[model samples]
Target: MQNPKMLIVEDCPAQQLFAGQLLKQLKIQHISYASDGELALELLKQQRADVMLIDLEMPQMNGVELLRSIAKQQLCQAVIITSAKDPLLLNAVATMAEADGLQVLGSLAKPLNKELLSLCLSRRKAEVWPADFERKAPAFDQKLLRKAISEQLFSLCYQPIADMNSGQIIAVEALARWSQPELGMVRPDVFIAAAEQWGLINELTLLLLEQALQQLQQWHDLGVVVQLSFNLSPLSLSDVAFMQQLQHKVQQAGIKPELICFEVTETQDFTQLSAAIEALANLRLAGFGIAIDDYGTGFANAQQLSRIPATRLKLDRSLTDGVSERPQQRLVLENTIQLAHKLGLTLIAEGVEKLADAMVIKRCGINLVQGYLYHKPLTANDCTAVLCNSSEQQAAS
Candidate 1:
């Protein structure tokens, strides 16, 4: 394992030197320093640093401005130092910096304690790489997915999203589940990206749709008005042939188009914008609902949302991060809900990993919440069983 590198950007000479000494003591061999904001920005332009430690009060541009600059450059590491009492400023600076992917590793007060510095450095090491898929599972080959698809080796797990208020099993998000014949079970995150890299995302997606629609048809026959929500890949939206095939398959399923929802991550670039919009409009006109998935995490602006013909907004998981600590985050959630309501769009919150998180979302007036707290994604049989049981209970009550 390579030793992690650190970038210390402090305005004061003593503080910068102190950071350097701490890095040396920690046995971190590769260390870089920026005495002021300008030099730090210049250094970033020359070479990317693994993690950046920035002082909030720097001359010329200041730490916040440097953080923003680092973000514009697409540099991903940052740690902020400010006075202990000024947490609000620390948070404000962190949020502003994060917009550019310059995530704050941790916050350290001035007159940094050795223990605190060690903790920050350790945290910085963790954030150095954005979770490598291959390293985690070296045996999982990207090329193997092509064979997997050809061999019909993958499966879909449908996680039901019941309306909290109505307790109605309205929709299910199709999550990819895989159990390798040799390796046993592989995480979807590990294999899905591999599939995309190996040009099998579209194939995997279509397979899921076919399975989902068939299951939906079966559920409908049982008198269940279940809607199946399929995630839209950037590739799927851009491919005309895929869209035509999808249209044909939906017709073949003979299910109400309105009962099928296409959930896409929000994007501002609008690549294949006309084609994507046209296909989405066709789907909507055909009675299918369209939703913007992972709403707040994208580059979508207010005007962009107005232009898109989406019927629902699914809040990103990041919105709920640290909600318990930061009361103001509730305002963001509140405003998002209010905006969704104002736009006449159904709102669903994603990544509800805890019951407390769900309660917070419910109290904030969100209509639907999905996360591990409710259930992990289930197989088709399990999903059907859940919906049927919930329905029976509701009728009894």
Candidate 2:
């Protein structure tokens, strides 16, 4: 992070000079400039920089194309997109770059302020966060997969979800982790998809559920009472009998039904609509909460979402990552929160890594937030230790 070198790709000489001056004031002397992304790409091939300043409206090659090439070629340490264009467009471009597994520092609107630029520069992550937990996962076989599930080798970690107004952790969402033999940790997306294809999702789901509920009971006994959100596969959600399996487990663990919330991703289309709805309704009837996860992204429209009887709505990270920088996006989030309130759903903004993001979500009148800003996914022992610390503090007070 020291003496951070940067590349500025801009067609306008005056704009480039202004950015250069800002960097110079910041003490970034090792800087280079190019009139277009093509030239910038060529410069990067010659020598890469710690960060690249990209202009969206370049002539020869656009910023988006340059981003794709950089990601494919592994050029530069990171990127900060500068455009006088609409902030919404900037957000979309940032999303595009992140989707390609390229780390984006921040999107700066035109006539950029020095302080904002400085803030973005200071956010250079030492180790890049994976683009939505995706990777080229190691190959898995059905035999090995089934053996892992049966042996309970697949593990669970909990990410704390905080109540922003109170700054207290109100809930935790359970995420699965798997360390395949010899191959190390396998990405959840890959192994989960494999489980679904191999017709073993139910087995895997029950395995994690049992573990989560047992952990929740331990936390409750420690007076670290917080809600537990567990993701359910559609394959398990459609089977009404799955409700009974969950209920029996809850009873055995002695965790109240009200403390458990089942989360279903809205990004994927619900093909088994009727059965899934029936299961959800029954679960709600039994006092278990339902949350529409990843609400803004994918196939779940308002009409479809409204039909599901959800008790909570999780705004997808796509909508919140740059919420503080994008006024229009904040307006959208505020209206979405309004809609969720009218339907009696508690709202949570996910992937809140910056204080600015938390401020914007707080301004939007949503209280709950979840992401690396608060905590990463942690193992049961690690999480329970945090709970113990909080409990001791409360007792001391």
- How close to the true structure is residue 276 of candidate 1, measured as C-alpha lDDT? 78
Looking at model 1, the pairs that clash are: none
TM-score of each: 0.68, 0.90
Candidate 2 versus truth, CA RMSD in Å, comes to: 2.7
Shift of residue 388 alpha carbon in model 2, Å:
3.5
What is the C-alpha lDDT profile of model 1 across 83-187, one tens digit per residue? 444766776666676555655556666777677777656544355534442154546676677788777777888988878887777789887777887777877
Model 2 local distance difference test score: 0.84
Clash count per candidate = 0, 0
Name the 10 consecutive residues with the lowest summed lDDT in model 2: 129-138
How far off is residue 85 in model 2, in Å? 2.5
Candidate 2: Cα lDDT at 310: 90
Clashes of 2: 0
Instruction: Identify the runs in model 2 with alpha carbons over 4 angstroms from their true place.
Output: 128-137, 391-397
